[model samples]
Target chain A: MTVVATDETGRATPVVSGYGPSFAEQQPPRNERRSPRRLPRGLRIALGAILPLLLLAAWQVATAFVPAYRLPSPASVVLAGVDLAQRGLLGVHVGISVQRVLLGFAIGAAVGLVLGALIGLSRWADVLLSPTISAFRAVPSLAWVPLIVLYIGLQENGKVAIIAIGALFPVFTTVAGALRHVDRHLVEAGRAFGLRGVSLLAQVQLPAVVPAVVSGLRLALAQSWLFLVAAELLGSSMGLGFLLTDSQYNGRLDRLFLTIILLAVFGKATDAVLGVGERALLKRWT
Target chain B: MTSTTALPVSFRGVGRAFGTARVLRDVDLDVAAGEIVAILGPSGCGKSTLLRSVSGLDAPSEGAVSIAGTAVGPVDQRCAVAFQEPRLLPWRSVEANVALGLPHGTAKEPGRRRVAELLELTGLADAARRRPREISGGMAQRASLARALAREPGVLVLDEPFGALDALTRLRMQDLLLDVHAAVPTTVILVTHDVDEALVLADHVVLLGTDGDLPGATVRRVVRVPGARPRDRGAPELVDLRAELLAGLGVPAHHTAPSTAQLSHQETA
Candidate 1:
């Protein structure tokens, strides 16, 4: 039963397992990784890391012996990727492409959410908007490329328009579908609790739709990247897509492989971030 | 009834019908403040619909529903409902789902306390952090109870709340509900097809029978239960009453007798 004096000479309480500042913020000790000598987690991670390394090694071995036109060796392509990244030219193109994708994604997502929610919320809105949206969506993202290029010129607007178009429909369709399935019972429950109109929508329906919307966003993110490459090929000065196209003119297969690998990794990274968010959200309700 | 200012719930001339079928006809029921009333009925009877009307999930086609004399058209925050299925958000932790039922304006610290209190009250204190999928059906229902009680409603409406539990669990829930009701003194309107449950929990018992023409309909008969508080589940009088209700429900007088207290399997199966 001893008290300790701190810097200000104020009395300090003794720390005990369940009786200290830590006690105030107590949580169950997390289950230990539980491998006196190690098991599932280490094995899983090792397996994950090893597969990619093995693939790269195999690809490099094949490329070293194979002719240059078809496939570049893994080491050379990685080196080329590093060289492109360091040159500042690759960064400029990557930066502009990223900016266009993000800006377009934001705009498309915003518009999609509003329209999707509106249609999802009401039969009248659904009736008015569904057919037109379906028709527009049926026309592929690439088909809009020519039209947008003609109207806005194949530059910033065209690339952005392409990404926006690519990102929009998935989000829109997902939101609409999610809205449709967003638990009729919960909405009625909200209304019963004196929540009406917009309050009901905001409080119950919107949160319910989030997981589905997140799924759509994940799809849209992947699609926008694919569409970005296609748009860049038409008339963008720089981008991962532009890099690929420009490399093809001189048949620099190494740079093409590098950009393609970057796209795959970048798309996977977006999916990973999305997976994190989805897990977090699912954790909230379940 | 209007003169009884203390009464928290009052139903007047409440009649409901769909197309040509009548569910409730000129129904009049009143729940005194802190009183618990159980609505007992047969299958296809509108016991659920009646409870839904009280919950504002379904509006009575005739007459009106009022809370402290305020006519209710839609569900209000003043009452909380627990369904048979534990219709939870499925994405929220037990605690967060419980917290969601809280009225928006409540301050955080006290609201958190209330959520904790409800969790503890429902015997779900340890499972608050668990997800619905991670818990047993009993625990999920317990969380559902916590969610309903978190609102601190003037009226607590339950529709076969324990009709899904195992026999032992259902008995435990019945007792738990009785204890909680004693503590909170909120007007509880429990709808069930279990006459034993109605007798044990209700200060007043309402017997409901089906209307022949109505495919999805019901009508209720109010039966006042008189005896000491916490009526014994094993008592002879309760057994007789339950049997009478069964007869009223069109079960043959000599049918297989069920322990009405263990009513969970009866209704669901």
Candidate 2:
């Protein structure tokens, strides 16, 4: 039978000769094609800045009409930040919170990954462990603070334990779910090729879920910050959370706003670092 | 690479069941060393189940499958399978995916050399560095075949390896499989639905279907195709066999010439 070739214009041309058009000849220059056009980086950044800039302007306008003790001006919040920095308290609070988050996140995520893999790969492990873990996950984050303090006794470990509890569930849930749903066909293929146990987990199952693991870690990081605030606000003497409570008690609204801003900035900064790693991982894995 | 002898495969009253439903039953067949055999059947006829039994990916509820005189174990190492979906690891480059099939404990250098050679054999050398998602379906299927060959398996199991490709690419892949068999001369057990594919490739084409009211499929008929490797697709003998195979598969042979129609009727009877 004669082959019919369709040109770009949608007209069919009959081919009477040898082989039909080669795959290379039929394919568009896909490598040279770029994704849909996007705004330039500088313009995109400027566009993103518009709302925050408008909020700052609105805040400045509000300070003129409202009482300074209630709603601090942006300049006064900056000045309060400077006051803390001058006294060396700002660095200590920020440093302490960051250290807590990083340590708790590392320990929690590592445990989550191990437990998640176990539950995911084994039916017996999942049956035995999942019910209890799910029930624990249902408990509110603040509910753990009292227990943590009672057990670990209001020390660095208590705060870290609280944060660790916050961080564990997201990583555990995502990793278990992702591993459970990893392509059965791929796993079967790997098995047919002589892979089993640890080799199968490393070579096939784990790599398949790298994207899920990264997203889970990002969620856990956010949870760590939330739990850190809960821990510090309840019992800690020095942290961003402590600064927030101390400022409110002393009628230092400016310092409270400064602490809130620092938390937002640091939370976003850590997430952004994770985002960079995610991009690299997706490039390599996906 | 030195010429490695292919292993013989034997099945004795093999059967498989998932819960209460039986998919295959009471089948017996023997494949000589270095021979090519095709299992052709209708959809849901347990063709893949039979092939999986050879690779030890699935065990028969009754009877046994032995390779080279040994009963097959779970995840048999002597056989390699190329499934219908290519099944290349999407995260890995084509070259790395092929290397994954190397026998366990193969030294790094020798494994690399074997993968490179199979890549060349499958005409995937150029796309070796590309991820499976970056390549076309046909190219990905070639990578799958290359990975299977990298095992240097005693029996190469292909479960509809080209069934997903377009018609033109399928025809090309058929020829490529022939070339691969010629190069390695390893025992190949190919499962496919296409009558032409089986006729063009296998030394013996085993037709699998239910016998009257049997609950599960077994070997219905074994048609030994009469031709050498790379047989002409449109040859009169192949066309006649194709009509007969289709008739056995329950398709009407009314469109064929009168004499072939009579032949198919008699064969089905």
lDDT of each: 0.74, 0.85
Docking class of 1: incorrect
- Candidate 2, DockQ to 2 decimals? 0.31
Candidate 2 residue spans exceeding 4 A from truth: A1-35, B258-269
In model 2, residue pairs whose N, Cα or C atoms come closer than 3 Å (at least 3 residues apart or on different chains), thus clashing, are: none
Per-residue CA lDDT of candidate 1, range A10-81, in tens?
011111221212212122222232446656777889888998999888987887778978888877787887
Chain B TM-score for the candidates in order: 0.87, 0.94
For model 2, how does the per-residue alpha-carbon lDDT over B1-269 read when each residue is reduced to its tens digit? 34567999999999999999999999999999999999988889899999999999999999999999999999898899999988888889999999998888889998898888888777678777988766777777888998988888999999999897777777777777777787679999999999988988899999888776668889888889997766767777878888888887878655547354442322221
RMSD of each: 9.5, 5.1
TM-score of model 2 vs. true structure: 0.92
Whole-structure CA lDDT of model 1: 0.74
**Total backbone clashes of candidate 2, pairs 3 or more residues apart or in separate chains:** 0
Candidate 2, A22-60: lDDT as tens digits: 444423334433456877889989999999999999999
Which ten residues in a row are the worst by lDDT in model 1 chain A? A2-11
